[model samples]
Target: MTAIALKSTLWSLSIKPFKRKGGTNLLLNASDLALGLRGIGWNWSQVHLAPETRPTSSKTTFVLWTLASLCLHIPVFDALHYAVQSFGPTTFGTINGGSIFDDTLSPLLRYSRSTFISFLSGLVIYCAIRITYDVATVFGIVVLRQHPTQWPPIFNSPWRATSLSQFWSKRWHQLFRDFFVGVGGVPMTYMFGRIGGVLGTFFISGLLHDVGLWGMGKGSDAVCMIGFFIMMGFGVILEGFWRKVTGHRVDGWIGWIWMCTWLLGWLNLLVNAWAAKGLIGSLFIPDAQRLPVKIFGPLS
Candidate 1:
């Protein structure tokens, strides 16, 4: 329901006509117009009929690839899900068994545990999104008879990102690119310049995320969501400053270290906020259906 609402809202805000073939289309009747708008709303990335080099894969190959991806991701997701469940929901900074904020533990142990949980939560989210994208791509190509080009890979090796700008713009899934740029980036660019545009886009992204949390009855925390995103925007700006001063782009091992430190260091703002609200207890896959849970039982 949250997704549908958000997508519908994005569609409403879209200025361009999301035709399968771009440009003007003749709508004979109200039904045609309605269906056309519905189709546009359904296409999250607004993919259309466009010429591209990548050829469509065989049905057999597609099935095998998707299956392999699921085989790899399912177990990973299940393990993280089990671990998250074990931590259980935090209540007023306390948990049933243990927590990242447990004062009884040493400072090193607490920080390390929090960082690990944050990393696990991030991976779990990535797996869930990737699996969903793969299944949806298959359904679109095989069942709906949509062109494979319209369903390009949703992600492009985000973990390899060496810079904040590269991570957000090039590597990460750009499903919300158009929406963010159109609604926030463009206007801010006109008003205050490129820096403002970057900050504004991140601000909107943070706002939307917190809104989603609020819609889910989790009670939004602006400090967690908005603060994290704004800090990321500043990180991108700082990288730009470094390049200007040093005449060297942020890349290689040094860049990777800096990126990891920035992300992981600030990640707790979002992760701990969700954990406090019991979001970590939410299960992605049922325990009875998880192979690892069946074989080895839940994590201790």
Candidate 2:
């Protein structure tokens, strides 16, 4: 609710008065004014129509793609449910001890286990976000008769991203882009220029994510959560420096390795923090619906 309120306030500050085609004013009609405000206010992504709207054939193609995405994510989500239960919560456990890794296993094996858990947890999060957005797209296009352009994909192939900046700006979900710009980037830009805006945007993002953790009972870990995001901001800056020196964009096999190393290296901090707070153990999916959980009855 706090997040929604922040977005709403930003929207009100940014929105302009409604206009219509052929010089007619939507402001004159009370019903039209209310509907327009509601629609624009609710669209968090701020997807807008281009001068040339898509044809019906494009809509059909979108529906097919959305269906394919849903098919791919459902079974992956189920398997993730199984894997997470098998591993138990807290990959490295708490600072005082009591983690899944606190066993008689070799140090190398424990590190590998923790890495696998971190990647698994990240995949589950990605699947959940994709599935929810895909379902919403289907409902909007099929049931509500909305245009395909209005329901653009929430993600843009994040796995293909070769740099932190590309990953955050182009590949990742952009539902909060304007919110971050409004609350952090724009204000900081006035005082400290573009780089400051970049840093500020990430700082605010980290703070809000921790706030979300706080809302989820015992999930807040400001140090890990905020530190991870700030590090990402610095990573983006480092990439920019590399581009300046090399005169080449971050891409291809080498860039992919660098990106993976950067992300996976720091991923444990955020994932383990959530695990320690009991976020991973929370019943996200009911056992009856999870095939492996139903058969094995949850490993630990």
Candidate 3:
């Protein structure tokens, strides 16, 4: 099958069960449970075009998807953040302080420092929460398979892959990526190249996220929205260069570069967390408590 077709099949398979009774199965067929499955599947397949997947006209489907996402996301993100805090060496204070430095230099330098720092802090917190949720899910899946009753639903399986690209493809929100691919990927690829396609997809995804968060009165989310775009842009350029140098095949030195790229992406989680914490504390903490802040300069 073609790449788009394969993506469509995967999307359909992943979301089909939600349309069924009890939302417990993955098969797709004509049934009351599949009420909005067609819309979801068609949208993912690029067969249906709408301003957005959650059309205003389909109040029922929109509500269902929103509620479902909330239920699933809340617990997962909470646990993920908890895991990082409890196990990771770095503290939240350090992360907030570090983020300040990130914003001080970003395009937001034109904006108020306080406002930029505040938004960056919120983004870091949100990302930490998401990471916690993902990690907890993985732990849950592994333990549950051997002793189902011993583990509560508090955690879930980690995504299916360990690498950054794999994580992007499998662990992160599939619907979000699929929607971007359908809406923007083809045009970007046609206009620029594969690198442009990836970067454009991520950039638009960031903007969409920012707009949504802004509309909901959460201006802080824009930090993450912008951060994602920047990171993805850098990644796309790096990947393109690597592909060209490696003759489109990763082997020998090319493999090493690829591995390093993946490692750098994962390390960004810690780097970003540090930057965010640094930024937040700089704004809220008192001068007396600012010694550590100054020493770390926002990444303390």
Candidate 4:
């Protein structure tokens, strides 16, 4: 089975230890190993024919992406985020550099606003990333003159996701998928069962995310983020059951609603906790008078 194969691969990676001369284990922070393995430089040794045309433009892709990033960083992204929270029954605003948890708002309204802001945040981020990728890739083709034998896709229309499995495997980016699989998913699948892979992947991701949250001053809310991911793992399991029982996965508007209920709806906890702890503040530029950068920004 696929799980068995993954388990074997994980075992092999575990036993085949490689260490830096300075005694650092890159595996400890799996990102390093994953990046190294996935980087084009690492795989370029393989034989491949170069593309016939290596083209780049100054005005089209790169310029547009730079402008988009500017808009998101300057006005639109943070402005929209602030407007959503303020427009709601509760402001959830920053006061004296802290989050004011206004209780005047109804929970339904609060959740709705949170969902809206999160949606906007996600949309801006997606656009930013896509544009950034476009800029870098075009730069490579034109400036670096590196001919891509085959260009990998930037995304797979994540909105079309019908199930958590499809979302994770197909819709979502695969950059960190290998990290979870190699680090925990495989062993978990072997020890437990099919669901083990799901749980293991999610839990490992949760820990990583918790670390990130803690770093962002959300140490108090890190547990919420971890729980959020574990909940997603469980949701994935339930989706699997739905497919088995109904002879189809949740799809169409129903599927979208189901996915959003858990993914976006459940996100309220993490975002609320994060907002309370001033963690969300780290994400955007300060009010018009300020910017996202700070003293520790370089190190962060």
The prediction achieving the highest TM-score against the true structure is 1
TM-score of each: 0.80, 0.78, 0.40, 0.66
Among all windows of 10 consecutive residues in model 4, the one with the lowest summed lDDT is 43-52
Better of 2 and 4 by TM-score: 2
After aligning candidate 1 to the native by TM-score, how far in Å is the CA of 129 from where it should be?
Answer: 0.5
After superposing candidate 1, which stretches have Cα over 4 Å from the reference? 1-19, 22-55, 87-99
lDDT of 1 by residue, 200-293 (tens): 8888788877786566575788898888888988898899889999999999888888988888878878777776665666555666887767
Ranking by TM-score: 1, 2, 4, 3
Q: Could you give candidate 4's per-residue lDDT for residues 30-119 as a string of tens digits?
A: 433333222333322122222223223433454455446445544454454454344322223442123322356797775666677666
True-structure Cα RMSD, model 4:
8.8
lDDT of 2 by residue, 131-201 (tens): 98789778867876666755655667778987788788877777666667677777888999877888888
Model 2's alpha-carbon lDDT is 0.69
Give me the candidate number with maximum lDDT: 2
Clashes of each: 0, 0, 31, 1
Q: Which wins on TM-score, candidate 1 or candidate 2? A: 1
How far is 210's C-alpha from truth in model 4 (Å)?
Answer: 1.1
Of models 2 and 3, which has the larger TM-score?
2
What does candidate 3's lDDT look like per residue over 1-300, in tens digits? 133443454456574442322233243323212332223323223222222333334434444444465566554443333333322225333332333232435655523443333343334455544445334434433433212221122212222333334334443434355546655565688899877677777766666655644453323455565576657556556655766886663335545455445544433443343344332222333534544434433332
Supply the global lDDT for candidate 3: 0.43
RMSD of each: 5.0, 5.3, 13.6, 8.8
